[model samples]
Target: VVDFAKFKNLIGAGFINAQRGLDDSTHAEKDILGKILGKLFRSGNTDAAPSEMKESTLALKQVVDGMQKTVDTDFRTGVAKLLPGLKIFGYPGISDSELSTETTLNVGTILESHTRIRYDQGDGLFLPETYNGLGSRNLIYMLFQLYEFFRDWQSRLIENGIYLIFIEEPEAHLHPQMQQVFIKRINEIVDQFSTTLNVGKPWPVQFVITTHSTHIANETEFESIRYFLTEKNQQRTTRIKDLRKEFRASDLEIDKQFLHKYLTLTKCDLFFCDKAVLIEGPTERILMPNLIEKVDKNLTEELKLKGQFISVVEVGGAYMHHFYKFLDFLELRTLVITDLDSTALESGKYPACEVSKGTHT
Candidate 1:
């Protein structure tokens, strides 16, 4: 069991690394799937035939199923709590218009196993717990359950009283087609279930997303798109919206530029500026040193004790979290002052600035 766990752990870790480095042609560990197959064969625990290999894979799956059964009590409970209204298709008296109070769920690999789906007792979707048993179902099957659960529940939520749907990282572990389908389903639910807005009536049910996927970004309405840039050491963020430019690619060509833009956005968030001042807007930024001069003729003088020259930078929005570390890396002390009215308040208060990088001049 310990050896199996080690093997599984190594295989899982390799998959994560492989996904991240898929774009690099020079990366040596490119064929992670091939490596996994080789490792399984080299273990020599199973017999040396193709049929034996298949049986070994099934045995591994069974072990997984046994482990999941032990943990699924908590997993099942958590899933239930998240779902309040669920009108399953098979249940009697479950009409389309009325909200459902109960659901039946099964979690496992229904696709791979010819096993019939018999439920214990519940009131939601089926999330199979085992399939053809090597220990349980593969991770991919588990993900599919989540996808089905969310998709159906979201459809109902929109039908009821959805004003806006905010999705973060919806593209995680999903293909581009699945991402597009998810969005299309959401739109369909909105049209099917929402109340039509009268001339001055507000539109009910809008969608807002913060995503890292280029495919998802491209599929969305161009007008709704916003891009943010961050400088790591300087601790700066710039938000741009309603861009007069559009970058698109045809099916024949890969959108490397769009992908590069996404990478650059992430890179800026790690920027390193030695000593920086964070300003709310363009004009006030220009006058920070002078304003500080007027407010405390000794502010810059005091800052000099930190041993660094300061540059006042204007970030489009207040995203100090992304830029602060970069500024500190460049040995800079940051003094950030922004007008609250111009920007939406972020979820949390500004973190205390770290000034360790710069020495007192």
Candidate 2:
């Protein structure tokens, strides 16, 4: 086991890093199915299982432990627990050995595993299959699991000198409102292990995240953010840390509060996209992707923009001022895709700002 005590002397922050991935490109890592199939045929570890648990097995343990703590312990959402049952195939299970309440789980005896999760989903408890049958909220469940899993996983890795974890789009398949909360809570995992292997000292685990989520970005330190400004074939990185250093030299003031507010209000996902298309009205929001895909090679060719283009659609011309601050700061090449006539809003019931949208903000 790696000792985190010496690690603290080298760094300041705690070990946990919850890197958010809000785009499709991030989904490559999220392909759990392909990953599972991948491990079956790989030629690396022989007999292969070492005396110690495999990396994947260790990851699964942290994930299970994390999920148990986050879900099963919280009263607001009720306690969600993960129960790993032994695969009773050719070998016999301990089903008849003891009372359900009295038996202790010994993981070594288990072959494959089946998981049971607890929540009030109409019925008393549900299986992964049960939730999948519902045909909704599957993505949300997975994201929550991933969040808790990595939150715990990072602390475990901190025993070593330094472990760098790269997090991609964390906001994929999550409801918009939950996006804000998810980003905010991910960092708390650091505090959970604030003094690991040391008294009053902190262990810093590096987490590098590339995100398209403004929500996640808002929760982070501005100095940590680096924007990719892509125009034509030229791309340059704008580091907020460097910007602050330069602005201080030039005696210029940047309104950071405006940046935070704009990000919070719009919750725009713009950090890692090639470009952005600003728009208003549902018609433009609904239609622009198809229209742009025909012309913009980046939207179709890039792995990040598989389903959607790199864009942010404003409510309309009326609210352009709200987003201007953010647009100006990033200096991103933003394409304004508007109806221009303004008749669309006048003809119909204006897009209700009070929309439930999804879960919570």
lDDT of 1 at 113: 33
Best by lDDT: 2
Local accuracy of candidate 2 as per-residue lDDT tens digits, 1-361: 6577765534423212233222334322233323222332121122333222256566555665665555434532332224333444334766544322222232222212322333466755544423342213334443444433333333343344454545556566556666667667655655554444234344345666666666677666555666554444446534443334423432233345445565567666666555688787778878866775666665435443545447665657665655554566666678876553422232444443333442221
Candidate 1 lDDT, tens digit per residue, 189-240?
4454323312233224455666666556655543455655454556575545
**What clash pairs does model 2 have?**
21-168, 21-169, 21-170, 22-169, 22-170, 71-80, 72-79, 72-80, 177-360, 177-361
Tell me the TM-score of model 1: 0.26
Candidate 2 positional error at 303, Å: 22
In order, what lDDT does every prediction score? 0.43, 0.48
The local distance difference test score of model 2 is 0.48
